[model samples]
Target chain A: MKNLKLIIQREYLSRVKKKSFIITTLITPLAIGLFIFVLGFILSYSDSEKKTIAVVDHSGIFNKPADLAKSGNTSFELVDATVEELKANFEDTNFDAILYIPEIKNLYAQSHTIFFYSEKSPSLDLEMVLSNRVKNKIRNFKIKELNLNQKELDALNTSVDLDPEPISDTAKDKSKHTNAVAAGLGGFMGFIMYLTVFIYGMMVLRSVMEEKTNRIVEVMISSVKPFELMLGKIIGVGGVGLTQLAVWAILIPIIQIIASMFWGIDTSDINQLSMDQAGIDQEDVMGEFSMIMSEIANQNWWSIIPLFLFYFLGGYLLYASMFAAVGSAIGDDMTEGQALTIPITIPVAIAFYIMIVTVQSPNSNLAIFSSIFPLFSPIVMPARLAFEPPIWQMILSIVVLIGTCLFFTWVAGRIYRIGILMYGKKASFKELFRWFFKQY
Target chain B: MNSILSVQQVSKHYGDYTAVNNISFELKPGQLFGLLGPNGAGKTSLIRMMTTITSIDEGSIFFNQEKINSDTPGLIGYMPEERGLYKKMKVGDQLLYLAQLKGLSKKDAKAKIQSWLDRFEINDWWNKEINELSKGMQQKIQFISTVVHEPKLLILDEPFSGLDPINTNLIKSEIFRLKEAGTTIIFSTHRMEQVEEICEEIMLVNKGRAILKGNLQEIRNQYKKNLYEITLDQSPADLSNLPGNIQEQVDNQIIIHLEDDAMSNEILSFFTKQGIRIRSFKEILPSLNEIFIQSVEEVEA
Candidate 1:
């Protein structure tokens, strides 16, 4: 234990103090900041409106209607001029181009020749408004000749419908309609964790492979056990990864705050809009949040946190130990190690992919089992936590994950003990299994 | 002197192929022992086992008569053939860390590393990253780190592989100085000349076994052919009755390779009869390189 601590300190400081490690830690965060900063600028700038349209009513037919243009991101101007006068002033570059609706004998025939021009293409909204204006002008003229009252016209423009709602515990937050959406987001985060572990865990493998291939591990194993060396390296590099994660965690929130300041998003407006758009109420968000939080708060966390930490840490160690062993087994050089990394990482990769597709249905036998299974638990458990799950199932999953860690730890250690001293020949799976089972 | 290390018939077998086959050797306190072999001769495997970097299959190793196992590996320093220090780590930092791993406290490690750097005239390199230094300089840093804890045994494998003459001498002197301070060394190299100059005892291994092992002088003598080079004012006369045959004739010397333990009187009498002034007469010893080649060849044949 004392020796292991010494090795850990050495591994941590040597790696953390390295110029490459420091440079990467600083560079990664800076890049993410630059990316977000640039992306925000582009999004806000691109959303501002471009060309404007001018409207003209020739037949006095649009006199008593609501104003056709709203002044928000878009602007519309009404031009009080006759067709001849507007056409004569066409050389003016102030307006992109003009829309002229000449007085017509047959509205439908004349409407076919509707004019819409701009310095470039006009907006779809502007064209729709222009067409609506022409329709109204002709309709009013027709109505004026028949002497139809405003009440009669109003009565003819409306329709009726009926809708009923179902009541449930999830109904309140369901109004905002994101509890299910929250499940989807949970799935997304699970996928991200899966991918992150896979990516950086392989980095652990490669680091082991590199040191082993170069025979550096031979010197290291002199004063340290193969297990200590493996633990120290995984933890040391794992600390580097955690440092990166902490930076991202801190930076992302800061970016979100900065972004929110520049682009204001009103909850009421978004909720109301979604409600009107989706025909669901906005208050369901409240019900859904409580449901999700209550579910999260009720988990068997004493069991899960330990199991999760075990699986999270143990899974990495188990795989990384085997990776280190494999690296040691490849005594030649780096090219063979590079070629071997793919197969070494395949198990972790499979766990990640399986965790991703199964997160939404965590209690779905697959996710639960994978969460309990040691090889997949590093990914599966975190993902399963996102959805509401039964306590016994969480316990079972956790038990399985713990068992998995213990099982693989021994297996990996056996391989590592034998593998760390081997050289000059590449080890295969069959031989490795043989080594693992070989008695002392 | 006390024995600092002992290897008793230790053999390392890898699946049926024995890397080190029953090679027994020991290093006494302050003794600089050399392990010689050609490429693939298992010198590294033996060193690895001695340093506890690799396990042995057939026998036990002892550190100061305490059987060496996991409990006592810290007492040995192993500088492998391959460069093991993290390249991107600063010299002082890496040295300190590795020293700490070898059981030194931070304060002591720092102090020791500083003095070593100063002694090597590489105080400026302390802050530089390992990768930033030239190979010789890196070797120096590695050497410093290897000895930082002042272990009971120090093992170096091809320690001069990439060094220039000046740097090589610097390292060589430091190694001698370490030995003078009572450190036992198991030095492994293919460079036989180094062994000839510094090593008192040597074990030459080939094909995974010890082909020759003894005092360096004795081993050299074992390969001796009693060859002699003599310079005379004129060719020695009475040649028809000389006991030993003259092998070759140079402008000023007669080269004789003796096949028997005969008295030089016969040769001396012939030289006197011819009235030749014998300028020089001496037997040349076999070089380690010649002995190594001949041994390998004899085994092959």
Candidate 2:
């Protein structure tokens, strides 16, 4: 027990003290924030360049140039010129493009193809804005010709706001808004779990390979059991993973708070700036934002956080032990390591894909089975947790996951005991199986 | 006195291939015992079993008159032939970790590491990573890590392989000092001369079997052929009908091989009757290297 503790301490401290670990832990959140900021900035400014379009209309629907509306960066003006003349000399004039509206034989036609001639193609946003304006004008003309009541027509358009509530008396009350928030949270948690498993599990593998290739395993085995060494390493790397997660959780919010205090550059400020620049209604965005915040507040975090931690640890242990075994099996050949690692990574990658699907259909048969399956549950089950998966399913999944973790860890210990000391020869999957059954 | 370690017919096998075959040996307290064997002669296998890194297939091993088990590792120090230390770890931290793994408390490990670093006069190297140190410096650290816990039995395999002569002597003296402090030392190497100088009792293993075992001097005496070299004052006029067969003669000295029943006095009397002055006479015993090769070849044959 003391040896195990020492091994774990050495494994944990050695990695935690590395310059790379410190730099990465400190810099990643800032880099992500900077990236989001730059992206939003670029999106708001991408269409800032203004352009003028000259319209030669013969359809008489848009009778006056003053009735034509300007949207965003594109402005429209009526020109008293023929289509041929505008097309021939549109670039010579100040206008960026010439729009020709041909005479329509039927005002109530299902579709009308208009012509836009320019040296460069118009932006999709500009095209959509122009079409919507013309469609609205024609609709008004028809409405006036038909003598339709605008008030009655406006009142006739109805939208259904769905409130999904459980019919069962035992089921907890969950609003649709809360469900949306839960799905988003579940996705984020699942993604974090996936990243934790891959990053930290690979860390365990590299550490094991380092000890094996360095031939330190011989000395280490002489002092402690291989099982102790393996378990210590898995737990140690897992601790590093938890430490990194905790630091990020605390650091990102603190950094945001500091940035807002110093520069008034919080996320909401950026969102507001981008929304204003894009001509979106601030009230709608703020309303949605507050709704999301309230829904997040309404979540049962006391249960969710613990479940997230449980799945994260369970998934990490399951994969990290297998990774350690692969590391031990690998000799000096790097290609062999890659070959051995593929089996472990394939399931993780598949589980990530299944998680994406599970978020969309939380109660699907595929989601239920995968969430219950030990290999996929760590990722898929957490994604379904927010939807309040049946309590029995969660319990079964947790039990299976824990049992499988113990089983794999034992198997890995067996392989590792023989593999670490077995050098020169690259081990195959068959050989690992043999070692698993071989007595030491 | 009861032996500190006793291996009674211990064996190890890998599938159909036998690594160690019914090998038995004992080490007395404070004895510098040599485990001599050629490469692939099961020296490492036997050591692994002794250290409890691998289980014995047959027979039993006892340490301090108690049956060997998991706890026996804590009482044994092992430095494998393949020397290794964590390259990115500081020397002081690495030694402390290894010592702690061997059942030393953190405080004790720290104190012992500090004392060892001070004794080696490398106190400044406490914070330096193993990779930054020279090979000899790393070797010294490896040695310190092995002995920091102060086990009752110390097993060193090719301990001086990478050491410079100066560091080699330093480690050698420390090893001697440890043995003098009543630690039974197993010095395993194929280097015959060093074994001859350091080991009092030795076992020669070939093809996974002990072909020779006893005190070093006694073994040498047992393998000695009745051969003698005599330095004469002058060359003999005729060499016919000598008491012994002349193996080699150069100038005034002659080496003779005698029958098992022959006496040395006969040759001396024959020389005196020949009116030749005899300066000195001594028996010649075979070197350990010759005996090792001969025994191994015999086994192979």
lDDT of 2 by residue, A1-440 (tens): 88888888888888899999999999997877676566655555547878888888877678765667766677888988997887777557898888887776676787887888888788876777777677767777777777899998899978687888789989777666876787788788889888999999999999898888788889999999999999999999999999999999998887666655665456776787667546578998888888889888877789888998999999999999999999999957778799889999999999999999888889999999999888899999889888888889989999999999999999899999999988887689999999988867
Please report the candidate that would top lDDT against the real structure. Answer: 2
What TM-score against the true fold does each predicted structure earn?
0.81, 0.91
DockQ of 2: 0.79
Task: Please list the residue runs of candidate 1 whose C-alpha ends up more than 4 Å from where it truly belongs after superposition.
Answer: A14-52, A56-65, A70-89, A92-119, A124-178, A262-311, A326-339, A344-356, A359-362, A416-440, B234-243, B257-262, B265-275, B293-301
The interface RMSD values of the models, given in order, are 2.7, 0.9
Global fold similarity of model 1 (TM-score): 0.81
DockQ metric for all predictions: 0.51, 0.79
Over 4 Å off, model 2: A48-50, A55-76, A81-93, A102-105, A253-286, B230-237, B241-243, B250-253, B259-282, B296-301
Q: What tens digits encode model 1's per-residue C-alpha lDDT throughout A229-303?
A: 777777776666666666676866675565446556333444554454344555766665576566556544675
TM-score of chain B of each: 0.90, 0.90
Which residue pairs show collisions in model 2? Answer: none
Candidate 1 global CA lDDT score: 0.70
